[model samples]
Target: MTLRAGVLGLGVMGRHHSRVLNELEGVEFKGVYDPSDAVPSHIEGKPVVRDLDTFLDMGFDYCVVAAPTIYHLEIGTMLASRGIHALIEKPVASTSEAANELRDLFTAAGLVGGVGHIERYNPALQSARQRIQDGLLGDIYQVTTRRQGPFPGRIADVGVIKDLATHDIDLTAWVTQQEYVSINARTTFRSGREHEDMVLAIGTLSKGTIVSHTVNWLTPFKERTTIITGEHGSLVADTLTADLTYFENGVRHHQWDDISQFRGVSEGDVTRFALDKKEPLRAEHEAFRDAVLSGDTSAIVTLAQGAAVVATAEKFVADGLEHRLTTP
Candidate 1:
């Protein structure tokens, strides 16, 4: 059975979804819908509805709501009401309450809903998490992430937290299986926009492990990197390159009475990892389709998970603002 998928909002990311839908085998690109179809036509045979109701009424098995953050609650509510499975973009809604309300609706509908935290699908991350689980890294300590780039003028709809940093926020916690105990952040605005263009956040996981995240819309060059430090070794990831570098450099402390003249030395090896041959977006969409077909929540980005990420981002923003007020 083919999974009929429709996408809302034909913007940058939405258009990417459309492209994947067209290329993905065993999936039907039912239609594409945006308020204005004035742009150069992309879909050939598929219908481009003037309104969303027609697309929803088409009885799509699953929908990808790539609309802006503010429209998430409204679009998700409508889809859930129709018993449609939807993969909404991250930071599920503009506010925590809104996220909760939509989550409730989905739970009541008993639908296989998901959030578009696409970074989780990255193959480097897939490999990293596998290594972590295999005890290769062994007891992770400090984790740092940097996702910075030129201002995404296209996404002025929300602050840096929801727009750019949400990916790192969710994936870090998910990979570690830890809850964010606290977040400290600092935000900056340069272009006189309502949202901050630069944000820096620090958080501690439940097991006393610490994580630091830095995201900005204004930078000299584009960058997406993650560094994980553990007891045995460390792993570095370049999301853009989809490359991984494992560093075995670590220090092992000895008891004060153990060494008489000097301590022994250890050398670490450098290992590089290669990513699989599929694009993350394609992998993510296919997972959504499979989840819809099987009603499996395992591959789905559960609403509670979305809420936790949003809550963490909100905390970062709050702390950032407070820090600005207190600092010189």
Candidate 2:
């Protein structure tokens, strides 16, 4: 069965989504919508609809809301009201309150609402998550993430925490199967904008794992990396290159007295796992398509999870310390 999909907001991310949808096997790229004249008359050989209602009237199985963060709540609510499934961009909405409203709208409509937390589809991250769950990284002690890149001039409403760090916030909790128990964060406004350009955050998870994230828009170059440390060793994943490397701990053999003086810590061996790489955006869209067809939301990022991430991101923006109990 072929599902027809529409792209909303023909911005940088929106164009990518439209291109991928056209390339996907079981999905048809119907068209796109943008208020401004930024989009060409034809995108990837398809017409660009300037009228949003006309685009919706084209009969879409789902729509990808890649519009600015400020418009997420409005577009998402429109989609939900039309009984159309939607795959909204990361951060879900501009703020926590709006995110909750979208979540409620989707839930009440019984639609397959998904967020574009595309990192969930990264092959390297997926492999790392599997290894951790399989006890390769026994008893995770700490997880550190670094996501830095130049300032995207397209963004005017949100700061680094909401734009970049939210990915790590969602991925960290999802990979560890834990809930954030407490969070502490600080922000720096190097750009003199109303929003922050850099953020440093530390959070504790339900399972006693410590997570730290450094995200900013001031970097000269881009980097997407994650490091997971455990008693046995550490696992490093570079999402940019789709590589997962493990550094094992060396065996310790010494006299009984030596145990007190020397800690048995040495880099044993370096191993990088081979992965069949695919574009994370394509995988994310495919997952959303499948969820709409299968009636199973098990694999996609649920609305509630997206809302939780937004709530956490808001906490980071507030530069406050918070302690919350895990809910069953």
List TM-scores for all candidates, in order. Answer: 0.93, 0.95
Query: What CA root-mean-square deviation does each model show from the true structure?
Result: 2.7, 4.7
Best by TM-score: 2
For model 1, how does the per-residue alpha-carbon lDDT over 136-254 read when each residue is reduced to its tens digit?
88888988999998876678678888877899988898788788887789898777888777898888999888999899988989999999988887899888988888989645566
Q: Which candidate is the best by lDDT?
A: 2
How far out, in Å, is residue 27 in model 1?
1.7
- Whole-model lDDT for model 2 versus the true structure? 0.90
For residue 173, model 1's alpha carbon misses the true position, in angstroms, by 0.5
Candidate 2 per-residue lDDT, tens place, 220-304, comes to 9999999999988999999999999999998767677858577657778888899989988888888999999997988899888
Clashing pairs in 2: none
Task: Tell me the spans in candidate 2 whose CA falls farther than 4 Å from its real position.
Answer: 256-264, 320-328
Residues forming the 10-long window of minimal summed lDDT in candidate 1: 258-267
The superposed Cα distance between candidate 2 and the true structure at residue 19, in angstroms, equals: 0.6
